[model samples]
Target: MRTLTERRLRLVGVAAQRAHDRLGRYPASAEQILVDYQGTTRSLIAESLVDAWGNPVQLKAGTSFDALSLGADGAPGGEANNADILLSELLASSAPRPRSPEFAGLQRDLADALHLQFQLDGIDYSHAHWRNSDLSVEQIQAALAGKPIPPKRHGPENHGTEPGADVSRADRTDTEKAADALFGALSGDSMLAKAMGFMMKMLGASSQARAMIKIVLADTLVHADAILQAQPAPLAELMKVLTVDRNTQVIHDLRAIIADEPETRSVAVFYGAGHFFDLEKRICSELGYRHESTLWVPAITIDINETGMTAAQLKGFRALMRRTIEQQLKQLD
Candidate 1:
């Protein structure tokens, strides 16, 4: 395996190439958005491989895998990660909190619902697609009604939406929030609230999606690694899922979505940049997606060493990622 330093350098290269391809320009910023595993379903591989890339994977994608893993109970909750990623293997094998037989049925049902929904639509139904897509609106209704939907929407840009303001959490309603919370434990006030609202609406009367600007946290890698070390489940399964090429499955699902919902085909998925591999003969070439605004971030080059994230550190980093958001908010001078 490459050392953390080498990985950083590689990450730099990936970012550079992606930037060139997307904007035909270079990045103007050095900071990378730290979210990858949150709000997305993963097999195991994707979780362990989060940000493990030496460089930023890809800034954007036409199809993304954004979904939230329910909290320890396998249900959504605040103060818990939406993705099942842990710093080490131990936590992986350990049973999740809600792995209860009762909830498992519903969980499986939802998964089945999601799987079949995607299969029916004949399109990429990564949770991100469902949550982010305009198709999701119709998807909820159609899924409830057991009726066919219209065509999926093209990539968001084709719709001509303003960049930052495009997605607002407030769109979800309160009932949706409960349903979403019922589905999975979405940490972070905003994520939990948003999921709850949307779910409520879909199930019946949902609340509007909420966007809370502050993520209060401050952690270092050391602390993160410790937390991982203490948890004793092998996370190999999750890791394997992340590294594998899932586009074919994604494609199959996307096609299914299209077949079922031909009218409201609009969907969007957001996930870690690493999923898009520029490697020769990789999925990216096969999947015609473009990257924009990838170039602005500068790559951090370092010699390859072992991964630097300890349990405490990983937690700390996550905390930092969250807290940093708060810091920025505090800086509104």
Candidate 2:
């Protein structure tokens, strides 16, 4: 069986490669590597990089970058697994490579599918696709500093409202605060809470579980969009936190905009698909509006042909994904 030191070395190599791919250079420090490559759904905790014997791994970059797990003795050289674990050895055959054109096309297809549109009461509303990757380092820093960042340009095909005309739907700061509170509640001093927290960490750290989680999160994001177009019942819990309160604020903004700006005959409230169901209900029932037309845009397409997986395998994978999402939703409840 692979030792903890071996697994951590592999993780460091993978994270370094990913950071290199994104930033055009390898991370200068081990701590920064995790920060740079952190995804919306996955995060690499600093403590996880420690060696099997509970020593901090030393990371350096020179002619070639290397991470050293100074073995059980916490000394330089020793015998067997006690020998220093050189990450360079693992990275030798694992250099970073640019994504293929086919892979880029698949990502574009996925992005295109994520953008959806709806026409209600003679106004066009589009679900804007926003991923954590869309924020630049400068923008993120500015946000942290409490400075207003410029609106993200969603490209010409977004078909959303004009920059100045668009009403803000949600406050990122509020969302962050809510998340902090929830995390604190989950990790409280209570024994049951601690056990639940431990289980969550264990599941998150498992390689198989992490891989399955990535697939499920991807599916949930796309499925959320599709559900918004068809029926959004499955997304009830997600919508409650993500959209309802924020969308209510949006409706209030719309009310003021309509009353103050008489010239504005049509208005668009651009938001994520998770918000659409609630928005639609509010507009039709409260605002005396009705849906005139609907447009379905492909946001993400998982081409089984390109995946090289058998039909049965794909079916089983999808079953696992559904169960994962269901379990997550239950936990949220």
Candidate 3:
């Protein structure tokens, strides 16, 4: 119920804002925001003025307009789900949505690197990137204050607490599901998997072989990492869509919240580790933030013996993968 109301508020409010801009005055009512307002097809209809609870949205016209949804109770004041929702507040909260320059540069650089790497390694680097997930300002503050982080809606369609934002996320989620299915089907026979399998065998081998292969494999894996940094699988293009592209909005929202709350002394952004590199650069370069400290947490752990490879073979196989990956990286370089 609140979800539908929020969407209408944003979409209808945006149309109303456009109408206001052209006429230099607020619309007399919600219905005055037309489908073709300012040559944009917002698809708004008479129903756009109707709130989720079947109450008409209250529109007060002035130099600046105020729109209101009377909540589930359809009354002036209430609490919880029945609380009043103000359109001005909603728009103000999300007003700082323009993409920052640093975000744009980082995205371009990553895409270029991925394209070049794919040409050489025939591997997708897209999965190497950070995945996008929402963490609200209130959640971060709660964590900082030693309180429990608030629970958020979880699943494919609920990318954000606000219903308006979920529209874009839904499209992204669909792409991600398809990409994941494709990635799973190809991973078994993929060169990366074979190389990893071989490496596991090397890890189980004798110390002498381990020592030699470790040095060589280390050098090779470094190069392989470079290749992984450069390319992403075509189907996994959704990885970039989910990780890099969606990050722009997240960063924009964070910046807005920060700006809106001038008294805030500290803010902690929580995201996948892969995202931090670019995010740090953006915050420092664009938002006038400085580096403070670092905390590392292990996200995953793997045991080599579980792969069912004997020691000697595992050592040799790792060396082979390392060398092959190194050569590929060198070619790209």
Candidate 4:
């Protein structure tokens, strides 16, 4: 019940912020927020304008706007569930100023959204793809900060060795070898290669497709894991270790950080996009966070012309892949 109220108040705060952006100033009151705010949905006004206790939320408009909920009591102050909830304090809005004139418009929005997503006052956590125990958090931080990455404790030189090399061959799994072969086939002059290249180009051209692909991949992993049971496939096990287990550890750390450091205002979690759905749910449900915004950045792009496939060829290939994916999903179900 308390969690639901906090989430609703967070949405109200988001609406107020959106109103500020559109109006060139914050709304004068909560009532104004309900009436004047333009959000992604019309029902947001009804859902956000009041607290869970059925009391009208109060808006404290000063130099900065704050959406206030007096809590379950509907009074100024009280204890336990009746304690005041301040939206301003709940949301993280302290983003750094743009460094240059070029950082205007979309770039500025991305920067602000990222800062708003995670405001770190105490400890910040980041996870890298490598499973090496030697790749410490400090090392990851240094690498992210553009410092020279320190050598791995055990086998830095072994990385990226020729596939036929004894160490490399021994280290490579069947799944990794198959992935490498699939990638190798993409450069061939065969019809399948051309089709695959066109599909890659199509994905690069459409951000929505890219996002949907991530969702599909995540869903497939869940189904695969369930089907494999105790004897899971290599890819599913690897994904569980990399995405699921790692996310669990990160959430545990976040929980400890919040509990130990009450003054900590913000927290930044740097993780791959595939891992976000579960992590976001855990944070919002367990740690009392509410989703406000998202900033999308393309990781890969390919020119369609470079693929040497005609428009018709591309369209046919895309449809084929879509049908194949749908069939596979149905089989999984």
Candidate 5:
């Protein structure tokens, strides 16, 4: 049973797949085919096929994406489009996807940075980042005002609060008080990432999901203290309680990034693993992946107990993550 969100995400995957499949049968690059179909410039095609939010879709096209992007506006322009993230066409592919040498150096640079980040010592290396999960502005404000945070799509840790509850941390978890006991107490990087993923899945994400992704990506370089310093007030204290310091900064940033760019309009977010049982269709519409030659966008499931995290399990976790990324890349492809 696919939720509306999953169905929507399938739109992007379907569109991409249609374009990809056409290439094998009819010919022409994915961009060319789409341009012909939409009768628009490659740059503007994404904006033509609007999502449920009624916003035009904007894609950062490539064959095998290092990362598939929908930009901040979820339309065409904004921080994401301008960010140094997706600078050029991702030409690498098993299928024909606009191969060009100009993007080669850019690809190498990104790959190198990504590889380094993956190898960085004491990098936490878990899928979980230091990003602060987004609390709906209304929900947080209500909680601050001593009102109920909205019932959010939260997990058991949250005890089923309103979607985007504007509230303080609930007395859930394994503790009577969340004094930073740390997740996966007796775990490694893979387990930690999975734990974080589990936490997120139990909670549905915000449209600011893109913002959250940004924070996770930031872990590649940006300092945690730096991000906290950037934010103001009690929010900082709240972030601290979440244990999103430099050690877990990336994850926190990703969540914060969502609310950071709200003016951009509707956006969809995807966690690394299948966590949600029911997410909206609007989000799934703009972004997605492919499976068994059929395109689909289902809630990603995180691995709570991943193998190869410890010294004895390194090889296994590495392979697991690689397979996940590889699958993601193909979806974006």
Candidate 6:
């Protein structure tokens, strides 16, 4: 027999598909689907439509609809009863796959650099990768339409006192003020700036981090290209933050599971190679776990030497990346 929650998820999937069939597009809001397709009275309160866990379901519209219940704990991701319930999973035929380009090369390189090991001693581990929310091809295209990207939900508020805002103060050195001015100007309406902004949004970058990347790009690409040409590990630090910090929540979730359920033997944290080092430290030192064993799985296979690029070209690319990394580190300092 289907549980009440499972039955509700089935109903949501049916209603979402019906709304899509009628309107030729997914409804923008859950209430719209409920009213138009499920025959719910317009006077029905939207908030009343919640899962068995009493959390309001989240709805996202794309080429198809996604209705999500955060599950028993009402958090983003979990296992067992707390695992997310997705309406699209119930109606897999009506769901569309995301069309984002695979970052196989980047993944491979980062994996090697991090020296990712797959073993944990005395524990049976399962593997799972952390991923961003699904976005359809249509959603990606819409985001790249050059419109101002919406600020991230739950992101920090802008109070006008953001970094570089005090560039013109008399107490500041001329060079310091000039640097600040340059950073500010990079955020202007120039074509290059606009293009950078668009690309950042397409990658689902946070607004604050995107702004920093723009400043670094402006400072390095515009003025110090030769210096970057001399470096071999450009952008390494920035890449670390982009790849590692973004998955902090995954670590938190793992810790929560271990703490809450003592019987959760043989836990598997299958994340990107970049994430394993920090996660290992947390798991062992903080959680009283020890490294046991690892299994190496090739996520991608590639040989840089096989690529048609000349030796000089490859060296130059590495140098440029190094310089980019150095500049990002400076900003942190």
Kindly report which residue stretches of model 6 are placed more than 4 angstroms away from their true locations once superposed: 1-96, 99-194, 197-256, 270-274, 294-307, 310-333
lDDT of 5 by residue, 249-271 (tens): 23334345555867654323433
Better of 3 and 6 by TM-score: 3
Error of 6 at 255 (Å): 4.6
User: Which digits, one per residue and each the tens of the lDDT, describe model 2 over residues 1-333?
Assistant: 126677688777666666665676777776677664334212333644688788888887654567888788889999876788888776576554443332122222222233211122122223352222233333332343346654443443333333453224355344344443443443344465556545545655544554444455577775564343343333333234445655665676677777898987767566767668788999888788887655333333344554455889877988887777667655554
Question: Which lDDT value does model 1 have at 241?
Answer: 30
| TM-score of model number 5 | 0.23
Off by over 4 Å in 1: 1-234, 242-248, 255-266, 270-283, 294-333
Candidate 6 lDDT, tens digit per residue, 1-333? 124666676666556666776678887776676565222332232433478878877888888677788889999889888888787676664443342233223322222233332122211333243333222323222232323324233444343443443434555433333333334434334465455445544543343433334333334544343443343332332233333443455565666677797886655455546556666777687678776544332332334444345778756755776677777656654
Clashes (N, CA, C under 3 Å) per candidate: 125, 4, 13, 3, 48, 18
RMSD of 1: 23.7
| Full-model lDDT for every candidate | 0.35, 0.55, 0.56, 0.57, 0.36, 0.50
lDDT by residue (tens digit), candidate 4, 116-194: 2212222132435223232343333233233554543444433243344352446556545443444345333446655
**Candidate 3 lDDT:** 0.56
Candidate numbers, best TM-score first, in rank order: 4, 2, 3, 6, 5, 1
Each candidate structure's TM-score, on Cα atoms with residue i matched to residue i, is: 0.20, 0.34, 0.33, 0.35, 0.23, 0.28
C-alpha lDDT of candidate 4 relative to the true structure: 0.57
Measured over all alpha carbons after superposition, the RMSD of each candidate to the real structure, in angstroms, is 23.7, 21.5, 24.6, 14.2, 19.0, 19.8
Query: How does candidate 2 score on lDDT?
Result: 0.55
Identify the leading candidate in terms of lDDT: 4
